[model samples]
Target: MADTPQNQAALALQMYLDTSASPLGSALQRAPMMNIGIDEGELATLPLVSEALTGSQRLRATHAQDLALTVDVEPDPARHALVWQMQMAQTGEQPGPRVHNFRPLHIALDGSLAPDLVIHTWRGGAQQSFFPPDAITPERHVLYPRTTAFYQDGTFTIGTHGGRSSDQYMPYMLITTADDSGGLWVALGWSGNWQARFVKPRGTSDLHLTIQIEPCDLRLPSGTTLQGPAMALGLYEGDAAVGYNALRSWLRSHMPALPSSDLSHFNTWTAMDANVDETRLLDAVEQVAGNGLHYFMLDAGWYPSPPNDFYSGVGNWRVDETKFPRGLEVVAERVRQRGMEMGLWFEPERAYHTTELATQHPEWLLRVPGREHALVNFALPDVRAYFRTFIADLVQRLGLRWLKWDFNIDPLPYWQQANDGGLAHLGHINGLWETFDWLRSTFPELTIENCASGGNRLDWALFSRAHVNFANDQYTNPDCIRRILGRMGTFLPTERLNMIYGPFQRREYDDAAWQVLEGSSFGVSEPIDNWTGQFRTSLRHHLALHRATDAYRSGHFYQLTPDTDDLCAWEGWQLHDPETGSGVLALWRSASPEEQVSLHVREIDETRSYRITDLYHQSGSQTVRGQQLIHGLTVGLARDAATLWTYHLVDGEENQ
Candidate 1:
């Protein structure tokens, strides 16, 4: 009998953990999953003892003297994935030496598996495709859908340049054999600067992989613990999609269930931009209330700002009396009356030099040498407490159901400059988590949307805390949105990627806009009151279609189109719900001269017949055998247009 994927994955994990079974022999039996450099020597070289924790899937490795490592492993056989968290600490009577190169996931794979290995990595951010003429610098070119690949015997190191984890490179990696016979997906669960190094020896298949919180050279006091970043490993057999789907499934199941994940939002940022007044906001709320939008988000600029100086007024969390003399309560109340929830934006991490938070509590601010605006140091207990109280008070006073947390500044310089022995980033991240935890515990129904100048903080660590992520600040470009959804959906769960559209005057691409929006959890930045009758009707139709297909959105996502920036090509993706035998397929014909293209459905039962309906065009349904759908389904779309379809298995009686 052929070995199941689960069996193969379990075997791979066991081999990975078995220190005694290495071909390098018993001398290397004390191999550690994590690596740390201390004054004495490398932590992995020390004689260590390992024991399992009682009644848990956790294991502890300890040295006779000062160091110890704890690994908590969660194996999900259903998804064929192994997720684990690792932490290293100083457990001795004296302070440990400044630690160097602290890596949570440091492993060496045997050489026998090297020849066919291929590494897939992605740049994380919105401006990935804006090269040379479009963007001033080459740095702007580092993001999806421009994926980077490394072959066997290649040595490459990828990492974030600043505090935002995914600002440069995504905190995920895929290593698969060229034949697609076997593969592994690894993800780092850190929201700060992280590095992953891959080295394949020239003559052997021995692969060395390590993930670390960079610029780390911190001392561990006797009682102090240095928690390394968390790591997750997934194993799969067959094509690369199997591994991607397995990781996505595990993440969706393990992460917190966000209330806003399924709700459609209407943000006022684009339309009002900071020039908002009480009458305007309330008017906007009224328009959004019954338009299939569940949340009326009064975005940035709601806070007090000096005339023509909104960017410098972030630290002030109070509503501007000039704009909202009645306060936000009136708008919130109106939203509730109209059957929609209220959401407000806040950038608590930043404070201009003149702001009250920065002027009065300068000690609580993280400042670099020349930067005027400083980060509200979450590492300080007082800072976290103050923000928690401030946000909670607003949440209660305005009856807010959602909060958009924005961090506009890059904090790496401030963190790296801290006097603390390279542990400033770790402390600040911990504080951030603690603050979010407190907020969640206080208001069980509140939803938090994570945004860091767009997609800067896109990583598993942040996703574990926040409900949904605003992909990037590029909310106006339909072409950009299409490419983002296609590329990001490779690793991220489509339902959690918040796609914001419009306020752009491109009326011709309205269908294309709605098509891309339907591919993920979406929001509208343009007011419905200003939309044309046709556009408004299209909005309502797509909104209803979005809610109707919410179930399939959370299932396995398959990108049917290639990840490219070619304007003359068809692009598409599919969301398949295996449990319900239903799914959604979205296609985009972007400037492509070709009017017809054939799409082959994936992961469907060939023996069954499916009822497929074109939801966007309101085209009637047709029944076709799943085999035929899998073989190829002809879809005709005009240039600069798109289509959405939902398919379900036909009932036995109907099939007969």
Candidate 2:
């Protein structure tokens, strides 16, 4: 089941047109020319104007109204992944915004394709059930879509739209056969709201997928060029893990490099919340400097005096001299003295009625007929330019090296039927891209972490340019952390996922430490002074273990266990570096009765013997042949315990 074009299915499209033209077929011999009507007419398939195989396994198609698209397919030996891009340019003689129901991309298979396959979609983000700020639980209330769907067999179509904050929910879907033999992975590259569908034609084995821009009423002026997001489809013939790995490979190859930084972050929000000051921050920097930490971040409330909070003063990005009489730069200097980079958190997309931006530039906010809070109209050229210059200047002047960019609220009542035309949310997202691009270019070394009211904004569209993500606001809840980390890791690099470690005053203490071991970048909210000797020593030990197992950053990932709703069950994952034959496995047992579980490791060379080192216990080392390891390795753990083990190929033992 290699991903070569010869093995993977090719697209044979049937186009519906308004003219006396016959239905276009893939057998046209040459690329065909089809005239398309701008109005929503009888179009059974995508109204393709032209198509060309752009590269090996890649296809490009253009439609009327200057809608250009490129579909790029990359075939791994066992899997074929396809990514498509859409761009719209103005067509002469026609002027207003164009509205059309773009058909879904179709994938047809002969009757030989199996009938037992399942279609899956994510809840977009943790806050999907909540529309505006009112319905949202301020901290950690909802957690159903832990970003997964149960594995089942049977042909069906499912999709999800909208996201953490942007337009489209989550932009990816996973479909797998009942036997896990093979399936397809679909992804969209747009940052704003979008729509996608996975449909298995009734009574037929064919699966048809369609992904298109949403809020289709989005207005683009005549002669204006609007770039839509791209959709990617991947076909693989192995298990879901095999398919996910291929998707990850495609992302790594195409997505922008993560912003430059060591990314060992420390945030104030986890510990101090909105209560922050220069003395406490400086103290935190000095204490954590010796713990192998690299970045110190000033979370919300740093920008204003005691009276200001993250909610109201967000739009006014200014320094509150009351908190830092010597200016924010002094804190930055203190951080630099301790050899740590400085980071500041900001919620730039939202503005409350009390802020200066809302008062002075009311027009910059996206206004719905009835809503109170205004979402910044980043799509507006002037607004984007202003924030770009403002944030860039702040970073440069303060010598800041990192930014914890947060979007706390979702833009609801997005548009009014009577006034706005076209997709306003889209424009806001476009502005997001513009601002991100400007920051990247202006400060090449700056690392920007994406946070949308705690893991709401987790999607590929933002990750392509942003460095790290605030997975969720629920760092204290081990179950929540476990769910987020395990599932999000299916697509995102483990290292790019940001998790917090803290005193865990309200919950189980050991859970926080376990969470720290699982995430890519580790953060501590509490002041170092509050850390007991035992806790501090354990933190240092875990940090050292993470450093040793750093190979996990670039290694291939495999989820060894299915996610369960039960907190008592066991779950685990492995990150293995094929080149070095080294990897790390993390296992956790909640309240489950199982005292010991047998884990079947994956992707190791069967000829080599691997030596497993217990990271937590450090009590002993054991060697097992890779073949035996794959069958199963039994590890004993007390109830509600977590442990990490690092495995490396034993030298001179490869032939064994």
Number of the top TM-score candidate = 1
Off by over 4 Å in 2: 1-37, 40-79, 91-97, 102-112, 127-169, 202-205, 259-261, 305-308, 416-421, 506-512, 527-529, 617-619, 651-656
Best by lDDT: 1
lDDT per residue, candidate 1, 586-649, as tens digits? Answer: 8888778888888888988889889988885566678888888888888888887877889988
Q: Tell me the tens digit of each residue's lDDT in model 2 across 519-609.
A: 5576777655566666667667767777777768666788787665566788888888878878888888776898888888988777778
What TM-scores do the predictions have? 0.88, 0.83
Lowest summed lDDT window (length 10), candidate 2? 16-25
What is the alpha-carbon lDDT of model 1 when measured against the actual structure? 0.72
Runs off by more than 4 Å, candidate 1: 1-31, 45-55, 60-69, 88-96, 128-153, 221-226, 507-509, 527-529, 617-619, 651-656
Question: What are the lDDT scores of the predictions, listed in order?
Answer: 0.72, 0.61
Cα lDDT for residue 138, candidate 1:
16
How far off is residue 127 in model 2, in Å? 6.7
For model 1, state the Cα shift of residue 473 in Å: 1.4
Q: What is the lDDT of residue 603 in candidate 1?
A: 87
Please report the TM-score between candidate 1 and the true structure: 0.88
